[model samples]
Target chain A: MGKKITIEPVTRVEGHGKVTIHLDNDNNFERSRLHIVEFRGFEKFIQGRPYWEAPVTVQRLCGICPVSHHLAAAKAMDVIVGAGTGDGLTPTGEKMRRLMHYGQVFQSHVLHFFHLASPDLLFGIDGDPAIRNVIGIAKMHKDLAVQAVMMRKYGQEIIKVTAGKKIHGTGAIPGGINKHLSLKEKMSLLDGKDPMNADKMIEWSLGGLEFFKNFHKANKDLIDNFAAFPSKHLSLVRKDGALDLYHGVIRAIDADGKKILNDVDSQDYLEHIAEEVKSWSYMKFPYLRKYGPKDGWYRVGPLSRMNTAEFIPSPLAQKEFEIFKAYTNGKPNHSSMHYHWARLIEILHCAEMMKDLLNDPDLMEGELVTKGTKSYEGVGLLEAPRGTLFHHYRINKDDQITMANLIVSTTNNNMPMNLAVESATKQFISGQDKITEGMLNAVEVSIRAYDPCLSCATHAIGKLPLQVKLYDSKNNLIDKRTKD
Target chain B: MEKKQKILFYGYGNIGRQDDGVGVVFSEQLSKWVEDNNLQNIDFDSNYQLNIEDAENIKNYDIVFFVDASTKESVNNFDISSIEPNSDVSFTMHAVSPGFILNICSEIGEHQPKSFLVQIKGYEWEFQQPLTAKTENNLQKTLIFFKKYLKKLLIEKKIEEIDLKSLLKIKND
Candidate 1:
């Protein structure tokens, strides 16, 4: 047996991370690990503040997904005050919020695909990391690059008109929104100034999908067998039991499509699942009741959310799900390989739903806010682009937030994602193979597949290229910042 | 077929991180008033406007304000008696600094129906709870000023021009 190799501080995700892969001289199988190294006490910090303020305050978690945090924060407030009747939200408000989130979905998914995930897929996994980026994608596919920015801009525009800002929507109040879109905006959200632009985008995306199809088709064998494992899914379901971002009952489903619980309440999350900590890092592994010792195995996020829901809400998403159902018998238990598919399907759904949202006559209504005051404790749950996000808050009588607890999607799936890295380690038998751009890019791509946002996960650690140290079994540095 | 101009006030910072979000807090309070008095003339746009391009639609607006806490190290927040908008700011790649954008916008164009800015002096910007005594105290004063500022625009019926076309400038360049 030989000492283990470490890839310190995995890049691309929200916060600090490290990957460890065990090696044996005999070319035998060994273990691997992915660990998240930092955690903040925002949950503990917000313990006694007013409840209504929690949404606005906690939204500082991550700029990339502030709305995700905002929705969760609002939901937490909703439960505390027990005012779920869409409060002061106008019919237009509800539809508008949905469209806003869909816009985020498109922005995030496009970013994930082109800026985050494309380098590995396009550059042959073992390609050059220096060029496999937004810049590289721009060079290789200029049209796609322009579309990504345009799409992200449009998404941000929707956020601006509805919630009040593209990233920091300061006016989206709990009872109701404080802003309204003009009739001009109502039309633009469906299709920008050039109505045919949407169609052009769709046609362009189909071509992109066709491009991805060739990659998947060629790597069918490698993808089918890589990082397949047992995992569960969890997400918010519509009251009608369909996949939804807001207003839903929680669902948990097993790997084999078996329903674990279809009507789980947010308050009972702790009772149903427990997280255990490893001394090596701050990340916790959420575990099931049947699983002894709260291990870092319980998963959450888009894949898990999809698994939990009985059906997809968008027709395009539903069609994709039908194909997914046929693939892994209803569970997509893998690494970065297929997350791209799940993500693209979601992007299509968002585009279609955005049109539906813009077409609603109620969206033009003026009375888009509710009139009331609320101060109570509650939990909010929603499916962030990455996974399941939870926001729990405790408020004082003054309606200020006193305590806050957040279960970010990345945190929930931290442990399982590590297991994935471990599984990938077994494939690199030729220890002589250099820590190629391909290998590191593959790992980063897989992490982005989660569309991982550490800022949301950690609520701290601003700026990027965060570094961590790696030590061999003998405590000697074999590799510093190289292979995963 | 008329475009509605934005009535935006840029505010930034993480509230939990102390005084970082003072600007945002003020914006929230002002927005509430806009809601309360049935101020249909104003609308809140998206969060931080990184580049001017991010808010291309702002060109359609008759007025735009960027609100934030100020303690002018370069001059002095107390120097506001002579403060005026500048116009040389070229939008940065990532963000259009509020003060900078205002200066640049004012330079190339004649005054629209109206435009104004309001600032509050912040004492402590460290991560803290509820505005500090100074910030809290200053909020009321700022609010009063904002109300008057808004009234000035309203009195001018400046929003009326938003319905006018051939006036929109999608790109500042």
Candidate 2:
């Protein structure tokens, strides 16, 4: 048995989070825990602010996926303001806004999969820590680097064309998008329709896939290709059997793969869903309608979304469906590590949707604004780079926001993260003297597996105070300091 | 052209940790002043850390200010100072540190330029919160420094407007 170890303040992602890895009495490894520490007051803060300000305020939650926050908040607010009186997006406005949203999905997914998520797959979790970055990946795999950069670049162009900015754009006013798309931008999106970039990226992904498949094949004992755990999916499904982003009702399924409710109304979402308060940390856990702290644990965002969607929307992504459906378990191919596969699946879907939107007739022809000036209370929900987002607002007769609430996707998936870390901790904990950095990083990476956007989860990033003291066998202080 | 007194401020720190993002907060104030007052202060770029290479043309600026977090002995950010120029000016890993950025650019053949560091004293560095009370108070002091600078600049302008010919009117008579 070896000494126990602890890792506080995990790094390499947005915002703040804490990860603790437990070592056995022998000191090898026993368990791992990735806890969401920082609590964002956005949810509690918005209680008094007007709903009209929800989109604008929540958009600031994340600089990366402002569009997602904008759309999600707007959609929810729309339900509140009206039964959906075709809220102010003129024909052109709808196309433009949808394009921008999909553009974000494309770019954010690509970033998460490639830059953020790639190291775990390409280098392997226990691989060199110093080199698990874009620059390192580029050095070892130049072709992959080029393809990934191009794919990400294409996604950025989508946002630039629609919102006139890549990351954060002041698109939403009280009614509709504040900006319009230009013909030149439309031409560029059409240019991406070229089979070349997609083909090249696909080729790179295939190569990277082989590298992993081969490793798993070679190290069957160390890496179980079928190492999967069961979990329910949550997402918005269109009336037809398709994945809907812009507007659709939220749905939650059970572990038995049964839909709890086919059409969960966004207006009454707070009723069916509950965010559990954790005293140990700032992050909140969302439980199911029937399940409470005792049994109501679930997942959200990409993994949950894939579970909920009827099938993949893009041809490239559909091929994944073909492969996964052939598997016996039939629930997203089982392997939790394969979440990256689902992310790539969504990226292809987003790109395809973006292309279709560019070709939509109303995209370039109609006014960007419509008549929503009658009443200003509206909510827009954006899929965000991470997952399902909620933005609610209630404006007075003067259109001044009087109340607001934002329940971020990270808050929803916080429970799943705790679960995943526990599972990984159980596997990695061995009785030995050494508590390696690789072991600790693996626990943190599992949290990163969810692409935790602490920034969005916490509207503001501030330093309060935390300290950790390490001790030797003699009880002498080895190291202790404050976070910088 | 007077080169416009072009300066590029790099605000680099971990925002989650109080006082770490002093550079960013200070940069925000400088940015507002430049925009509202239309000063030749040029640009402010905030990052998770600092990068000296970003200061490609250091000599271009008549004055450059570097703001960041420091715990060095006897040197609190509340007490600003000038650091000696050197190669490999150390900044943070993710982004450039203000002090490291100022020195590295000078060594990298960008030519030496006048530099000042306004390091803010850090309180808590791990928890997710905004600036600590002490740091926030220090920020006010930094703002005062800028306000005084603005006033001095105004005085200099007024003094310049009084031409030598006006003072020599008796001699001309």
Off by over 4 Å in 1: A24-29, A85-90, A195-208, A293-296, A329-335, A366-375, A429-437, A463-472, A479-484, B1-173
lDDT of 1 by residue, B12-131 (tens): 545655555566777788888889888765765434323323333344565565555665564233112212443322211122355434432332222332343445676774335677
- How big is the positional error of residue B43 in model 2, measured in Å on the Cα after superposition? 10
Candidate 2 lDDT over residue span A288-406, tens digit each: 66777656766777666667777766676677656645543665534555566566666666766766776687776666555432444444454565677766566676555666667
Per-residue lDDT tens digits for candidate 2, residues B75-107, read 543655564453321111233244444544453
Q: Give the docking tier of candidate 2.
A: incorrect
TM-score of 1: 0.73
Per-model TM-score versus the true fold: 0.73, 0.71
Which candidate should be chosen as best, given DockQ against the real structure?
1
Can you give the lDDT of residue A258 in candidate 2? 84
